[model samples]
Target: MDNSQRKLGTPKLGKWELFAYGQLVVPMAVIGLPLAIYIPPFYSGTLGLDLGAVGVILMLARLSDVFVDPFIGRWSDRTHTRWGRRRPWVIVGVIIMMISAIMLFVPQGQVTNLYLLVWICAIYLGYTLIEIPYGAWGAEISDDYHERNRITGSRQIFLLIGLLIAITVPIVASQAGSGATAASAASRQAMAALGWLTAGLLPICLVILLRSVREPVKGHSVPISFAAGVRVAMRNGPLRMILATVILGALASSINAGVAVLFFEHVAQMGSSSSVLIFALFAAGVVGSPFWVSIGGRIGKHKGIGVAGFASLAAFALVPFIIYWVKPNYPGAVFPAMLVITLIQGFSIGAAPILGQSILADVVDLDTIRSGEQRTAFLFAFLAMVRKFFEAAGVGIALPVLSWIGFDPQSHANSAGANFALTAMYCLVPLALWIVSTTIIWNYPITHERQARLRAALDRRTARRARVRAAD
Candidate 1:
């Protein structure tokens, strides 16, 4: 078919197709929560690895993505297959992730730091394989300004649901057996259950997604060298702006996730309620996804993200104060106050994943217009790599800092200074990062009108190329 005919024939993705695509995030989120929140504690406290070592090892594992993500992105973009560009990579990722999940989550014997490093690195590699291409696939599904919001919004909703399931699984598993189970043993049980759940759900979700959704027809696949792609990405102003925000924002989130349980258990003195609180947080995100999407439509995507970041900042700013002031004076009111703050922050959670990704899809259009090649996956990979780098940095920094401050996760009691340090790291640092991220993207230049123009230019360019080929 000709360019015009293909453009005319592009189908609006049905709800079922969107749901099928979104379903894949469930298993991924299942693994993600444990990696971010539970893994360090599990490996460090239960499995006898040092806290600082776990932090550094996980950081190194994620750093491995520095090379892997870009290579996979470029390879997937250049790959030609009957199954399509993105799907095949996703299939391979599923197999790798499944194997790694079993080994990492369900450890067999007395595993060492090296074992943790190897399996965690493998899992992250698998995650990169799926995430970079999976994100690019979603971007290719639609080019509409508002429709992109819908696409990402759907995925974000599922993502939150998956996180909620991840949180609930441990809570339920911990409670299912004798209530007297030691914390470490309970954690082990939870991880084992999660591993099996991930192993079972991944293939099923993959089959459904592969069967239900058709990959979008490629407009063109001009193979750009990795160096050339990097050069092009460097020159993209919007992409640079987005990456800056991604680094700051992801680092903030990583720190928060790294020390959240420590803060709740040691600083806040509410260990039992941590799981429920996290569940509430993500449940709020599930509810807030569409609200942020609507806000994105009414305002602009970047401004919407700025607004959400501000909201989160306000919520985080209250955390340390609440722990220090409210807990001592009216100890009974602390959890309720924290619950309120967490829900508020959670409501704003949808802004980044839903809108940030939608914004990146728009940025991809800008790059395509400039480079005359569809490098969507490569650009997404670039952003993903930046995000992972900072995320790893956050964990790498937070844990060692905690260890240095004399905060011990294995013990119930910590020094006042250590508790203060946890509070500051968990609350103040993220607050500062969010402020910077919000400032960077508040007036992002690519408005809806600009993206429409970019799309038009791409269409004209495609049509011109088609005519030349016809003439030949």
Candidate 2:
């Protein structure tokens, strides 16, 4: 069948296609979970590298993407092959990730700060290749507003599932060994397991996705230079608003992830149960995805994000109080209280990425109408860069700050001041950023009504182009 025929036949993606698309995220989460949560402490505490140096290395590695992301994005948009524009990059990314996962996750003899820096940079480069194109691919899958939610929502569910699996591996691996493993040893074991899991599942998932899902046909449009494309994207008001929220939300999430294990271990006195707690957190996110998506449909995408942000803010606000005050009064209540708080926070986690990307897809429509070019991947690349840069920044800033404050990850006898610093970094910083992000996005200009009007105008333009071509 021709491209138009295929597009007409599948106005909505089939379940199997969504399933295949979502599976790709599973391995990504497996790799990502440890990088954000486990790897910092593993390298610094277990391997005896300087904590501050490790943070700087990771942050610098992500900074490399400042040059890398936009290039990959523009390349993917311009690429044409029998396999497809996005898939070819995904193929290259899988190979890069597989090799780097083995090196970083399953380290060999004499690991050092330099070793950590090199391998981490390699892995992040691989991630950018896949993530930029993958996001653009999803945005192209369907034009309907709600269908965009379904596309992103499906990915969110699988992303959470992958996170659950990632955490479960370490919990099972640590428990399966001898009695009472040290935190550092447990983290090392977890990394090894995660390495194998990622290497094994990544290629298998890639094969399934490539075989099952077909890329959509590209419509005719005016081609623009990269410089011009960047200029046009800057002028897009909705894109700016959405990206502003993305920066804050992603920065908040990165801060929380960077220090979560440390805070739980040192502050909440829940080190041994860290994986279980995280598993519970992401599990709640899995269950809550559908509810948040429904809320987006009911109220509006931006408002739904606002509600989730408030829920997250409330949950984060309780952390310091629970650990510092409530624990002193009723020691037994801390874990239960923290568990409830974690669940509440995770439930709100699904809305940001799910609804945010949906909003971004609409913004892409607006840009298309104005610029007369389809630059979905390029725009998605900018979002990905912001997320990675800030995620790295969060770890980069948090770890060094903790070190400067004399908080030792290996020592149990951290001073009261050090413990309080960890708590504030984990809780208060994210809470403040979430408040800013929610405020910026709560009144986003693109609603369902506005998006429908944009789509109609594009449709009219497409029809006009067809008539002119026929006359010629």
Candidate 3:
């Protein structure tokens, strides 16, 4: 058994295929964006879940991702279906997303703390079924490093779009209902709409992937024990660095996301439309996302990522200073200042995933050389777990500190300490962490030249094997 034997088909990505791959963003965002942005705030403020309780539930829910991701990833890797290794799981994940999105909206009536925790656990588990497989599918679908970046960029863009749409839910619901208090009905309606919309878009995009990209077959299962497989992957230096940078970056970003609502609602006084403002920044990132990919292609992935992280650090570090300088000094100019910070961040945020995926592609190539197996999906699963754990730790630590700082959602503005916490989390802390992440990336060993060498060797081996088969 060899890589060639595992494939159902090999087709170049055509325009429609690209479109389909890009369309996956919708489902990804629909299913994922709300958990971070809307769910926490809604539970804490609207449903009367205590901030501390909300934080605990969120932390616990994210931790569940650690267990679920690898299991699903490993299963998806070994799965053989007429539809293909990735698509069947991709479809199943979407169906689960449709159901769970609805579950999230179902108001479990005045519940005990235990009941609420149980409901939250269910939601988190369902989300893992959707997210982990979906991410692995992205990695598995393309072997070309640049093509993978394009696919990932398209995915991230749609993800941003989904975030934009999700952000509008509160506003849309408010307008549909009489006011904020009764917007749950409106939200329910929105989720229903999103559910069907994602369900529809997913299959369509997958068709594009199915039709356009020919997956390399997992023709031969390595005889190595699974434990040995795990060991080989863990010991890979390039993969480890990529994982480290991603975990650190995810931690920093998750903490920033957890605190951003506070910054917008209280510090900036964006009011009920604060969600819109925050999402618009995300949308702006979606808009700017391609440039990052293009930059990576131009300068090389590692340098491109370094540049993007540097920009994010600068933008994040400037937020508080600009706010303080402009708020009383030039009241009307505050929005502009905030916009500047967000606009820059939008471009910078895309760097990690785009570069990370490219690096992962290289790791896949390397793994084949060292371990004599293509277990890209398995490695991605490992990443899925590491990413979830650190993200949990980030939100876990930040939320409790925020609660202790008296971050009452009902308060018109946070108390001075609460304000300090929000500002620091959103601005200062992330800026510092981004700097550290970039420094780690600077040490990344996979150069474009190295990738070229690996690919050339793989190609020659493939060609020689083909010639041997012909002679036989």
* lDDT (CA) per prediction: 0.86, 0.85, 0.69
Candidate 3, 1-472: lDDT as tens digits: 2323433222334555556666666656765665665566666766667777777777887886687676677777777887667767766655665555555655545644565566556656755665656666666666665766777787777778777766665456555654553224224454445545555665566565556554555544354557787788888899888887888888987888776766777787655545545665787788778997888777888888888878767777777776678776887777777777777877677777777876787788887677766666677778878888888887787878878888786567567778888788777877777788899997788877788787676666666767877899
Reference-based lDDT, residue 47, model 3: 64
Off by over 4 Å in 3: 1-12, 179-214, 219-223, 460-472
* Range of the 10 consecutive residues with the lowest summed lDDT in candidate 2: 1-10
How close to the true structure is residue 306 of candidate 3, measured as C-alpha lDDT?
87
What candidate 2 gets wrong by more than 4 Å, as runs, is 1-5, 8-11, 181-186
Clashes of 3: 3
Q: Cα-based RMSD of the predictions, in order?
A: 2.3, 1.8, 3.8
* Tens-place lDDT digits, model 1, residues 301-378: 999998998887888788877887899999998989989999998999999889999999999999987777898898
lDDT of 2 by residue, 75-154 (tens): 89889987789999999999999999999989988898889988999999898889999999988888888888888999
The Cα error of candidate 3 at residue 354, in Å, is 1.9
**TM-score, one value per model:** 0.96, 0.96, 0.88
Off by over 4 Å in 1: 1-11, 180-186
Clashes, model 1: 0
